[model samples]
Every structure is written in C-alpha cells, then in structure tokens.
Target: MTLRWLLTGRVQGVGFRPFVYRLAREHGIHGWVRNRSGQVEILGQGRTDRLDRFERALTDAAPPTAAPHIAEREVLAWQQLEDFRIETSQAGDRPWIQVPPDHFACPDCLAEVRDPTDRRYRYPFNNCTQCGPRYTLIRALPYDRPNTTLSGFVMCPACATEYRDPGDRRFHAEPIACPDCGPWLSYRPDTAPAPAAEGEAAVEAAAAALRAGEILAVKGIGGYHLMCAADNTDAIERLRARKPRPHKPLAVLFPDEVSLLRREVNCSEAELACLRSAQRPILLLPRTPAPSLPESLAPGLGELGVMLPCSPLHALLLQAAGGPLVATSGNLSGEPVLTDNAEADARLSDVVDGFLHHNRPIQRPADDSVLRPIAGAVRPLRLGRGSAPLELELETGVPEPLLAVGAHMKNTLALAWDRRLIVSPHIGDMGSRRSLEVFRQLVEDFQALHGVRATRLLCDAHPDYTTHRWARESGLPVTPVFHHHAHASALCGEHGIDEPCLIFTWDGTGYGADGGLWGGEALYGRPGHWRHLARLRPFRLPGGDRAGREPWRAAAALCWENGLDYTPPVTEPSLLRAAWQRGLNSPATSAAGRLFDAAASLIGLLQTASYEGQGPMLLEQAAAGCAGEALVLPLLTEAPPWQLDWTPLLAHLRDGRLPVAQRAADFHASLAGAIRDTARRTAADHAFTRVGLTGGVFQNRLLTELAQSRLQAAGFEVLLCRQLPCNDAGISAGQVYEHLGGQRGED
Candidate 1:
C-alpha cells in the first residue's frame, strides 16, 4: 500500500522532516519527506502494519518546536521504493504556514560550546537540529539555508557531511555552521578599529569593555542590545544619559540562577519555567525583603525584569563578565531597535562606546519579549523576539478575512482568518512618524508572510489615534470598536466565554459613545454585545490632554468638584476652576486611572507623571506596607447608569490628620471596596455570576489581587488576562473577537 500525507502547523523550520526520515527508517518503511508550501508532505509505500506503526510514530514523536497535524491523507497507487529519502524543498505562491519563533540555546548545544573537547568549543553559533535561530534569520518560506541570511556562506566539508548523514544530530539543521564556515565576531571602538578577533577573543574583549564601565552594542540573534555592568552606577548613569530614558526600568542579563538568587529575587515555579522556556522572555519576578541590588536600577518598582541569556553568544559574554549586566535595546529612546551593522555604526555611534559586531544579518528588529506571572499564568506583556508571530486559534471563525489595528499606546496588529488570529509583536506608541511607518511595515509583513488579504479593518473609535487613522484610510471596510468594549471582548474571547458576564474595564482614557472620555466602565453581556451599566462620577479634565501629563490638574479638578480650597500649588487653582466652569479646554471623563492620579497627587506622591501610568504605579508603591482601614465611599445604585461617587473619599483624603502613606493605602483599599460593591450590586441585579477584569489598570498587582479576592469571595468566577497583556497591546485581539462575533450575527 502507498499513502500520501500533508501536514501543517509549525513543521517547516523545526527539523520535522529529519525527524520523519529517521522515524521512517527505524520502521523499515520506503518513503520520502520534504517541505511544500510551509508544510511537510510525505509519500510512503510499505506493508500495512509497518505503515500504521510509522504513522503512529510520526504522530507521537515530532520535533520539539513543531505541532504537526494531518491536513490531508490519500491512498496512492503503489510504486514500491527501496528506502526512505529526504527530498528537496518545494516552493509555492504563498507562504501561509506558521513561521518558527526564536528558540533558546538547548542544553546539548550549550554543553558543546563550553566543552573543550568538542569541535565547536567556545563557538558562538554552535547549533544543531534541537536549537538555533529561526525567525530572525529567515527571509522567506520553505525555510532552507538559501532562503535565510546565511545564504552566502558555504558549509565546510565536515559540516556538509554531517548535514547529509541521517544518523547525525545536525542532519537537516539549516543554521548548522562551524568557526571555519560561520559568521565571526569583531570588536570595534567608537573612534578606532580594535583588533579583528574571532571566537573567544572577541567575546572576551566585549566583556572586558563592559567590566571597565563602557557601553557595548552587541548584536544577538534578533537585534543589537546595549550592555553595561549592573553594579557600576556610573556605567548605568552614562547609559541612561546616552539613551535619554528617564525612569523606565531596564532588563538585566543575569549570569546564572545563583547570581539572580543572590540579589534577593524570588522566582516561583511558573516564573522559573517561563525563564527557562524555549521562548526565553524577560520574566517580571517579585523582589524579596532586604534586597542586595542597588535601588537606582529599578527606582520605585517592586519587581525586576530579568532574563537568562538565550543565545550561546550571550552565555559566553555573561560567563566572561562574571556578573550581571544591564541589557537594554540598542537604539535611542522612541526609535526601533537597531539591526543592521552599518546602521548601528551610523546611528548608534554617539550612544555606544564600542561595537561588538557580527556578520549575521537581521531581516528585522525584534525587541525582547516580557512576561509577568499573574493569576497562575505567565502573561505576555510585550510580545516580541522569542514569542512573536503569535497564532491564536479562535473558538469560531470569521466570515471574511480581517485586520485589527490596535490602540495608540502599546500598539499591535492582528489578522484573523480560518479560526486563527495572527498577532504582531508589540509596536511602540504611534507618536512619531518613524513608529507609524514601522507599524505599517509590520502590517504588510504579517500579511505577506501569512498570505492574508484583509477584506475588512477594525480600529478603536478614537479619531485622533494614528492606528485608527491608518486603518480608516486603508481602502477597506472599516469598523470602529469602542475602546472599553474591545478590552472586555478580548478577555471574553481569550477565555472562550459565550455567556453574559460583568466586565470591569478601567484604564487611562478611551473615547466614549456619550461624546466624553471613558475609562472606568462596567459592562454586561458577551463579546460583540455589551451594555454600559455603570461608571465612576465624571470629573472635568482641566486643560484636556495636558491634564494627563500633569497629575496635579486631575487633583485640582477633583478638589474643585468637592468644593475644596487647596490645589497643590500647580498653575493656580483659580485658573483651573475657570477652565472647568467654562468648559474651555476641560473635557469630562469617568476614567479610573485619573482617579488614581488624583489620589496620588492629593497625597503628594506624584505631582507630574514622568511616564504613562507613573502616578498609579508610585501610588501602589506607597501603599505597600500600610495596614490602614479603607474609607467608605457613597454608591448611587438606583439608576441604570450607577455612580461610584468619589466625594466622601476625596473629603477624607484632604484631611490634615492622616499620614500620606496611610492615605495612599486607604485610597487603594477604598477603590477596592468600590469595585467590590459595584460588582456585588450589578451581578445581583443582572443575575450574572462571572466577571472579567481587563484594561491597563489591571497591570497593578495590588488592585488585581484585591479585586480578584473580593469578587471570588462573593461567589463569582473571575477571569483575568492570562495569555495577552491587560494593556493596549491586547486590544487588537479583542477587536478581532468582536468582529468575528458580529459576523455570526451575535452582536
């Protein structure tokens, strides 16, 4: 009997063909395996029992990175063959197959690099079938070496022999190379060319420069990263000055697990597993008491963004440095990470002290992905580098192909087709022309790679956002989804919820249907069909958008509403009162984020925000150890649009007798009470027992914990963001969900 099989999923670049060949040979079957149009295809002729065993083995024992499922199977005419052979890859018109994500260096490869007796001793690019770069080096589909950045390099005789031998581990590894035929490393100073060193010498030079308090722009698998000693405050300060980033925390490359533990970092089993996963993203782990690391590294944050080295090159550099090093994106603030060598030399020369250059070319720049352990799942915050080109399978399918253009901040794009939603990596805020162009390119690249011709586009209702504008002008059928609705729908879709639930969507700002700004929202229903049930009392935002930059304006607005006298000495209280009264530049908003900013400013913790969500983050910090009781607030539960009145809470916060720390802690507790009370009343009235917490404010661990505890105690099943982020990065996924639901007439 002869059989033909077509397989799909991540089966192209992950050594699936070689695994099949070996399995077939082990079964003594006559067959052939090859890649065709982003999938694996097989034709076999053998005894029925042997073929059945071969099929079982193929299903049970595939490559680590591949999850292949049979797309088609056909009984073929018998053409008895002698032995199994791996054939050449066949190209097609469209590459719709899943592209491989970057992988962490496997243990076997790592051991070979550090072992003196191994042929690839200390080799930075030593990789076999189990591990290596895949997405970053790949240029097109049918993932062969000629289609990657290593197309120009010819393999040596020894490596070629290993590639053809089915018994060898490097049988079909596309990135298989050695020192004689692989890319070499070199160290070049800013003003002078250092000695052209290869292998261990170049890595040592880079490490020495880092140890001596100099910043080195080192190229890795995805892109370049700026490296400096973590303990050297001078080097960190210099890097901060050069990059000009004021307060955002930088990720650190820990030398080993022991080094991270010495700094008083606690890693739970889930966090540890995420750190050691194939997609080695930076894990946000909580800090322990009496921490040894300098406070300047993270400034007011409680958790540290840390990661072990993912590549052999990174491992070698960290091993030589003997300590942790601050590893930040290579480019300056607000620009994309630098990938090209000449571009790095031209654009990053003024910022970096030296360059640890390599010959491998990066097809695109991908920032390191970040994950946080929350609600028992390692949630993705910034989906890039090792965990990008994300394919999420939806419970239902869409009628037509669609693209979801995400929000203005933490932007990402999604393409939905055939029950699969493909999300792009985290694109930076669309504030500059460069970032906007990059967003456009990402949309185009994803479409080209996945063979998606989007017939419809979905965007946020906010008119001024760059993402919304781009989608509207794309000459496709555009649908505008409300920001809070998008958030609620994304959570519902991620959990595959088809029933009504109470959703609390709280964040900084979103365009509301009432011609005002909305953030603190309570909705009832399922995806694509939700009704706004309640909101926090609306307050005027003095000076409109400027109030977001200055937290004191929000404080003044709240004080003016409560008939208070003080305004924290920011731009005169009378002027802000006039703006609020006349409705000149003031716009009314019901944003819970503004409430946090108001509370923070009232307690004198943050008057001006250095970054987005800075005030609320600092407020959480100040509330760390206080055990004060929560102050009760009034709740208006009579009408359909219930009000969470902040008047009584604000009055108590303005009291002179309370300590600032106690007030901050009380404010957090008070807000938690308000959410709990609102959920209780709304859930009882609507008879809904499930609640989903979404939006950017859910990133706060304290608030999330408080809300989850209170809601669960009230006998409600709580759903928090487990896969994607709670921020705007996950908005595209929500948009796609809503659109798909609308297609099925469920809206």
Candidate 2:
C-alpha cells in the first residue's frame, strides 16, 4: 500500500522531517519526506499495518516540542523506491502552518554547552533542532537555513556531519553551527579609546561590567535586552533614569537554578514548570516576604516578573554574572524593542554602559513573552518571544485573507486565511512614530511571509487610533471592530464557545458601539451579533484621556456623580467640576478600570500614576490577604439595557475610618458581586448559561478570580482566555474571530 500525508501544526523547524524519515525507516517504508510551505509532506510505500503504525507514530511519537496533526491523508499509487530519504523543502504558495516560536535551550544542548570538553562548550549560540531560534531568525517560508538569517554562517565539518546524520539531534537544524563556523559575539564599551572585545573575552567583559553595576545592552534570540545585576540599586536606578521608565516593573532573568529562584520569589509547581518550559516566558510570581533582591525591581508590587534564561547566550551570561540580572527590553520609553545592531547602538547607547551584540542579524524584534498565574492557570499577558506567531485553529474558515490591526495600546496584528489564525507578537503601544513604522512593517512582513495578500482589513472602530488610521489608508476593504466587542469575541473564540453567552468586556477604554467610551460592558449573545445588555453607570472623565494619568480626576468625578462632599487633591478642582458640568473635554465613560483608579485615589493610594495600570496595581496589592464583604451595588434592571450603579459602593470607599486594605478588598468584592448579579440577570432573561470575562481589567488576578469564583458558584460555565491574553495584545485575534463568527452588516 502507498499513502501520502500532509502534517501541519509546528511541522517545520522542529526536526519534524528527520523524525518522519526515521519513522519511515523503522517501519520498512520506502518513499520520501519533505517540507512544503509550512507543512511536512510524507509518502510511504509499505505494508498496510506498518503504514497505519507509522501514521499513528507520526503524531504520537513526534518531537516533544512539535504539535503535529495530519492535515491531509490520501491513498496513493504504489511507488517503486528502495529506501526512505529526506528531500529538499518546497516553498509552496499557500503557507498554512504554525511558525514555531523561539525555544529555550534543551537539556541536551545545555549539557553540551556547559561541558568543558565539548566543541560547543560555553558557546553562546549553541542550539539543536529541538531548541533555538525559529521565528526570530527565519526570513521566509519552508524554514530552511537558506531562508534564515543564519544562512550567512557556513557549518564546519563536524557540524555538517551532524546535520547530514538523520539519527543525530542536530540533523536538519536550520540554525546549526559550531564555534568554528558560527556567529561570534563582540562587546563595545561606552568609554571612548577602549578597544572592543570578541568571543569569550567579550562575554567576560560584559559580565564584568554587569557585576560592576553597569547596564549592558545584550542581544538575545529575539532582540536586545538592557541587562544589569538585579541586586545593584545603582544600576537599576541608572537604567530607570536613562530609560525614563520610572515605575513600570522590570523583568529579571534568573540563573537556571530553581533553588536560587525560590530564594527570592515564591514559585508554585506550575509557575516553576512555566519558568523552565521551552517557551521560557517571564512569569509573574509572588515575592518572598523578605526578598534579598532590591525593591526597585518591582516597587510596591508584591510580585516580580521573573524568567529563566531562554537562550545559551543568556545562560552563559547568568553563569558568568553570578546572580540574577534585570533584563528589560532595549528601548526608550514607549518604543519597540531594538532588533538591528546599528540601530541599537545608536538609540540605546545612552541607556547602556556597553553593547554586547553578535553578527547574527535578527529578522524582526520579538520582545519577551509574559505570563501570570491567575485564576488557577498561567495566562498569557504579553505574547512575544517564545509565545508568538501564535497560531490558532478556527472553528469556521475565513474565505478571504484578512488582516486585523489591533488596538492602539498593547498592539498586535493578526492574519487569518483558511482555517488558521496567526497573531503577531506584542507590537508595543502605537504612540510613537517608530512604533507605528514597526507596526506597518510587521503587517507587510506577515503578509509577505505567509504569501497571502489580505483582501480585507479589520481595525478598531476608533477613528483616531493609529491602527485604525493605517487600516483605513491601506486601500483594502476595512471592517471596524468595536474594541470591547473584539475583547469579548477573542475570549469566546479561544474557549471555542459558540453558544450564546454573556461576556463582561471590562477595560480602561475602548470606542463603544454607541460612540461613548466603554470599559465596563455586559455584552450578550455570541460574536457578530452581540447586544450591549448592561454597563457600569456613566461618569464623566474630566480632561478626557488625561484622566487615565490622574487618578484624582476619576476620584473627583466619582465623588461629584455620587454627590459626595469629598475634597479632591487637585489644585483646581473647581475648574474640573465646571468642565464636567459644561461637558467640555469631559467624556462620559463606564470603564471599570477608571472605577478602580477612583477607588484607589479615594483611599489615598495614588493621586498621579507614573505608568499605566499603576493605580490598579496598587489597589490589587492593597486588597491582597484582606477579605471584605461585598458592598451594595444596585442592579438597575427597569430598562432593556440595565445599569450597575456604584452610588452605594462609593460611599463605603470614601469612609475614612475603614482600613484602606479593607476598602480595596470591598471594592473588588462589590464589583465581583455586580458581575455575578448582572450575569444572573442576563442569563435568566436570555437563557444563556455560559459567561466570559475578558479585556485588560480582567488581567487583574484578584478581580478575575473573584468574578470567576462568583460566576462559577452561581452555576455558570465561565470562559477565560488561556492561550491568548485577556488584554489588548489579544485584540487582533479577537478581531479575526469576530469576523469569522459571521458578517455583522458592517465593512
């Protein structure tokens, strides 16, 4: 019997072809295996039983990191072939395969790197087929070395021998190279007249600088990272000053030692597993009560964003530095991470004391992926590095190629064609010209890489957003997706909830269907046919977008709306009140995020936020370990579109006698109760039992857990984002999913 199969889902760059070749030989099959487009195609000529076993093993015994599925199978005419062999990859037209995210160094590769006698000993670029650069280095499809940035480095004799050996781990490894032929590292200190160092000497000098409390811009698998000793307050303060990032938490890369990691942060088994996973994303874990690490790493927050070394270069540097290092993205505030070496040297020279870069050029930038253990799962917050080019299977097919330009903040782009959806990594906030340029380039690069020119585009409904404007000017048919609707749709799509459901799409701000700013919204029904059933009672945001930075504005607005006589901390409160009364520069919003800020400010937690989500973070922190009864938040259900009134809740938050922590805890409880009541009312009316919690506000662990617990206790099937984020980073995927759900009469 003869059979042909097309396997997809991470079939390329993960030793899939070699594994298939070995399986064919083991089963006494005589044919060939090759990569076509982004998939693996195999032809087998063998006994029927043997072929069946081979097909079963194709998925069952595939590479540990590969998620292979037989996308196509067919009985073929008998072929005369002597032995199974690997064939050259074919760059076919329709690429429908998952681009493998960059992987952490496998244990075997790490062992070889650490071994003193091994050829790749202390080699910063050591990687095998099962581990290493995949998406970050690849320049085009078929994932062959010639299509990657690594094509410049010719393999040495030993490496070539391993590459040709089908039984070897390095077989067909696209980025395979050794010290004799691989890319080398170079370090240039900031001080003039100091000569640059190369190879091991460069690594040593960079490590020495880090130990001496100097920040170094070190290149990694994805992009450049500004790294410094975690314990060095001077270095941390210097980086903060240079980057001008005052309070946004910095991620720290710890040595690959669990014991050392546990000394500073409390890690559960799942968090530890996530930290050591092949993806090696930065995991937000709780800090020890008395952490030895400096507080400046994550000031005022009880948790720290920590990650294990994801690449050999980082592993070697950690070993050399002898401690954890603060490894933040190499960029100025509100800009994309730097990928080009010359650009990094030019833009980040003022931020770092030296440059530790290599000759291997990065095709694009992928910042570090971030995950937080929330509501009993490690949910993705920022999809990047080892977690992006996130591909998802669609429940329904998208007939035409579609591009979804995500929201302005925490931006990401998505491309959907056939039954697959590919979401780009977190493209930083589109607030700067450089960031917008990167966003535009990423849109083109994604389309080019997939060989799919999108016939239609999806973007946020807001006319002023950079993504929306870009989409409007792209000359493609544009479909405007409401921001909150996209968030709700993304959550439902990820969970595969096709039934009518009630979703609470809460965030800081989003352009609403009714032209008002929405954040606390209860959207009923499924994607493409949702109805705005309920919302938080409207409150005016004085100074519009500026209210996001000034928590006092939200507090004053809440106080004024509730008719409370609380004095605000602002110098010109009367002017703000007059603006609100006259409706000048005051946009009425129902955003749950602003309510959190209002509560935090009312309790005297934060008056002005240095970074986005600072007030909410402090509020969540204050609520930690405290349990308060749910305050009364009346559900006004007299009308078709109900309202969640916060009149009673505000009075409790304004009580000066109550502990701030208790007030914070009660605020969260009241919101959760409001969610439960609203879900119950909506479900009772519509007979929909499933509920979804989505949007950036749901990224708050405390609120998500509380709401999820309440909804589940009320006997509702709750859906939360698992593979994708609940934040705007997942908006592109949501936009694609919303379009695929059905036509909504727009576009």
Candidate 3:
C-alpha cells in the first residue's frame, strides 16, 4: 500500500522531516518526506498494518517542539522504493504556515555546551534541530538554512556530518555551528584604557565589567541586552540613570539552575515549568520577602520579572557573572529594542562601559516575552521572542485579506485572510518615531512573509492614534473599531465565545463609542455586534493626558466630583479646581484604570506614576495578603445603559482612620463586587450566562481573580484571556475578529 500525507501547523524548523525519516525507517517503509510552503508532505509505501502504525505515530511520536496534524491523506497505487529519504523543501503558492518562534536552548544542546570533552564545549551558538532561532532569522517561508540569517556561516566537516545524520540531534539544524566555523564573539571596552578580548575571554571580560558594577551591552539571540549584576545597587542605579527609566520594573535573567532562581522569587510548579519551557518567557513571580537582591530592581512591587537563560550565550554570561543579571532591552526610552550593531554603538555608547559583540546577524528584533500566572493559568502580558507570530483559526472565514493596526500603546499588528489570523510580536508604544516606523515595517513584513496582501485595514476609532492615521493613509479601506469594543472582542474571539456574553473592558484609556474616554465598560453581545450595557459613572480628568502620569490629578477629580474636602498634593490647586469647575482641559472619562489611580493617590500609595500603570501596581502591592470588605457601589439601573457609581468608594479611600493597605484591598473588593453586580443585572435582563473580563485592567491579577471568583460563584461562565493579552497588545487580534462574520448589533 502507498499513501501520501500533508501535514500543517508548526511542522517546519522543528525537526519534523528528520522525525518522519526515522519513523519511516523504523516501520520498514519506503517513502520520502519534504517541507513544502507552510507544511510537510510525506509519501510512504508499506504493508497495511505497518502503514497504519506509521500514520498513527506520525503525530503521536513526532518531535517535541512540533505540533503536526495531517491536513490531507490519500491512498495511491503501490510504488517500489529502496528507502525513505528527506528531500529538499519547495515553495508552494498561498504560503500560510505558522512561523515558529525562537526556541530556548534545549537540554541536549545545553548539555553539549557544558560538556568539557564535547566539540561544542562552551560554544555560545550551539543549537540543534529541536531548538534555536526560527522567526527572527528567517527571511522567507519554506524554512531552509538558505532562507535564514545564519546562511553565511559554512558548517565544518564534523558539523556537516552531524547535520546529515538522522540519528543526530543537530540533523538539519539551520543554525547549527561551532567555534571553528560559526560566528565569533568580541568584546570592546567603551574606554580606550581597558583592553579588548575575544571568544571565551570576551565573555570573561564582560562578566568582570558587570562584577565591577559597570553596565555592558551584550548581544543575544534576537537583539542586544543592556545587562548588569542584579545584586549591585550601583550598577542598577547607573543603568537606571543612563536608561532614564526610573520606576519601571527591570527583568532579571538567572542561571539555568532553578535552585538559584528560587532564591530570589517564590516560584510555583506551574511557573517553574513555564520558565523551563522551550519558550523561556519572563514570568512575573512573587518576590521573596527580604530578598538579598537590591530593592531597586522592582521597587514598591511585590512581584519580579524573572527569566531563565534562553540561549547558550545568555547561559554563559549568567554562569560567568556568578549571580543574577538585569537583562533589560537595549534601546532608548520610548524606542523599539535595538537590533543593529552600528545603531547600538551610535545610540548606546555612553550608556554602557563595554560592548560584547557577535557576528551572528539578527534579521529582526524580538524582545523577551513576558507572562504571569493568573486565575489558575499562565497568561501572556507581552507576546515577544518565543511567543510571537501567534496564529489562530477563526470560527468563521473572511472573504478578503485585512490588517489590524493596534492601539497607540502596546502596539501589535495583525493580518488575517480566510480563517487564519497572524498577530505580530509586541511593538513598543507607538509614541516615538522609531516605534511607529517599526510598526509600519512589521505590518509590511508580516504580509510579505505570509504571502498575503491586505486589501482592507482595521484600526481603533480614535482618529488621533498613530496607527489609526497610518491605516487611513495606507490607501486601503479602513474599518474603525471602537477601542473598548476591540478589547471585548479580543476576549470573545480568543475563547470562541460567539454566544451573547457580557465583557467588562477596564483599561487606562480607549476612545468610547460616544466620543468619551472609556476604561470601565460593560459591553454585551458578541463581536461585530455589541451593545453598551453598563459603565462606571463618568468623572473628569484634569490636565487631559497628564492625569495618567500624575495620580494626584485623578484623585483631585474624584474629590471634586464627590464633594470631598481632601486636598490633593499638586501646585496651584485653586487654579486646578477652577479649571475643573469650568471644564477647561478636563476630559470626561469612565475609565476604571483612572479610578484605581485615584484610589492609589487617595490612600497615599502613590501620588505620581513614573511609568504607565505604576500607581495601580503599587496599589496592588499594598493590597497583597490583606482582606477587606467590599464597600457599597450603587448599581444605577433606571436607564437602558446602566451605571456603576464609584462615588461611594471615594470617601472610604480618603478615610485616614482606615489603614492604607486595608483601603487598597477594599478598593479591589469593591470593584470586583461592582463587576459582579453589573454582570448579574445584565445577565438577568438578557439571559446571558457568560461574562468576560478584559482590557489592561484585567492584567491586574488580584482584581481579575476576585471578579472571576465572584462571577463564577454567581452561576456565570467566566471567560478570561488565556493565550493573548487582555491589554492593547491584543487589540489587533480583536479587530480581525470583528470582520469574521458575526451578528451585527445596533449601531
């Protein structure tokens, strides 16, 4: 019997062809396997029983990193063949394969690097078929070595032998290389007085500089990382001063040893598994109390962003440093992560004491991915590095190709055609010219790589957003999706929730359907068709966008609105009050995020936020381990569109008699109760049992867990973001979902 099979899904760059070759040989089958555009094709001839086993094992015993499924299978006339072979890849029309994200150094490869007798001992570029760069190196589809950035490096005889051996782990590994034939590393000191170094000595010198409390810009798998010893307060302070990032938390890269990682942060079994997974994303775990590591690493926060070394280079650096290192992105403030060596030197020369350079070129920049364990599951906060090019199948197909340019902050673009959706990695906030350029380039790159040309574009309704403006100027028809609606839709689309559901989208800011700024919203129904069911009672934000930076402005707004006499810590309070009364620069907002900011300020947790979401983070930190009763937040349901009044909670937040921690905890409880109450009333009226919590505010673990538990206890099926983020990073995906054929609600 002869059979042909077509396999799709993460089949390329994951040793799928080699695995099939071995499987066919074991089954005594005569066949050939080759990679096609976006898929794998296999032909086999064997006895009926043997063929059955082969077919079953094709998916069951495939490579660990491959998620293969037979897309098509057919029986053909028998043909005699001597043996199975791996054939060359071909480019087919309509390429639509899942681009494999960069994988962390596999255990086998790591073992090889650590083995003293091995040829690849201490080789920073050691990689096997099962692990290494894929998306960041690939220039086109049909993922062959010639299509990658590593094509310039010729394999040595020993490496070439291993590459052709089916039994070898390095078989067909595109990025396979050694010290003799692969890219070499060099270290250059910023000051001419210090000596330069090469190879292992380069790593040593970099480590020595880090130990001496000097910052070093070290190149890694996807881009350069600005690194320094985590325990060195002076180094951290120097990095902070040079980077000009005062309060935003920095991610620390620990040695591969989990034991060492556990000393700094409290890790659960699930978090440990995620840390050691092939993706190796930075997991936000609770920090150990009284940790020896500097408090400046994550000041005023209960959690730390920690990651295991994702590459051999990172592992070597961590091992040489003899301690944890702050491995933050190599870029200027408000810019995308730097990828070019020349650009890094030109921009960051003054910021670092030395440079650890490598000849291995990165085709693109993929910053480290970030995730957190929430509500019994690990959820992505920023999808990058090992979690990008996220592909999803739509429940309903679209007729034409389209692109979604995500919101201003946490920008990520999405391309969709037929039933497939491909979301780009996290593009930094579109606040700077460099970031906007990256966003535009990413959109073009995604369309080109996927071989799909978008005829239409989806953008947020806010006309002032850079993405929205770019979409309008792109000469393609544009669909303006409401900001909060996109947040709700992203949640609905991710969970395949087509049924009428209520989604609470709480974020910092999104342009509302009614032209007001919305952050706290209860949207009913599904994608495409959504009804504004309820909202947080509107309040004015003095100083417009400046209120987001200064929590005191939000607090003052709450005080003035609620007729409270408490004074806000800001200059010219009387003038600000007059502006509030006259409605000069203040904009009306129902944003739940601003409510948190106000609560944080009123409780004296934070008066000014150095970074976005800082106030809420400090509030959450203060509320940890404290239990408080939910204050009464009236549910005003007299009208069609109801309101959850936050007025009653303001006084409690201002009460000095209550402990600040208790107030913070009570604020979270009260908001959760309000969400539950609003959901109950909406469900009672509409007979919808499913409720979703989405938007940037849902990134708050305590609030999301509390809201989820309350809703679930009230007999509602709760839906939360599991794969994609609940923040604006997910807005692009939701925009694509809106056009995927859904019942249209009232405009």
Instruction: Choose the strongest candidate by lDDT.
Output: 2
Once fitted onto the true fold, the runs of candidate 1 whose alpha carbons sit more than 4 angstroms away are 91-96, 193-199, 571-573
Least accurate 10 contiguous residues by lDDT in model 3:
738-747
Question: How would you encode candidate 2's per-residue C-alpha lDDT over 324-443 as one tens digit per residue?
Answer: 999999887768899888898889878888999899999888999999998999999999999999988888778898999999998999999888889998889999999998998898
lDDT of 2: 0.89
Evaluate all candidate structures by whole-model CA lDDT and list the values in order.
Answer: 0.84, 0.89, 0.88
After superposition, which runs of candidate 2 have C-alpha atoms over 4 Å from their true positions? 193-195, 744-747
Tens-place lDDT per residue, model 3, 545-649, is 999999988998888887877566667778878888899999999998999999888888888888999999999989999996898799898885688999888
Cα deviation in Å at residue 646, candidate 2?
A: 0.9
Winner by lDDT between candidate 3 and candidate 1 = 3
lDDT minimum window of 10 residues, candidate 1: 255-264
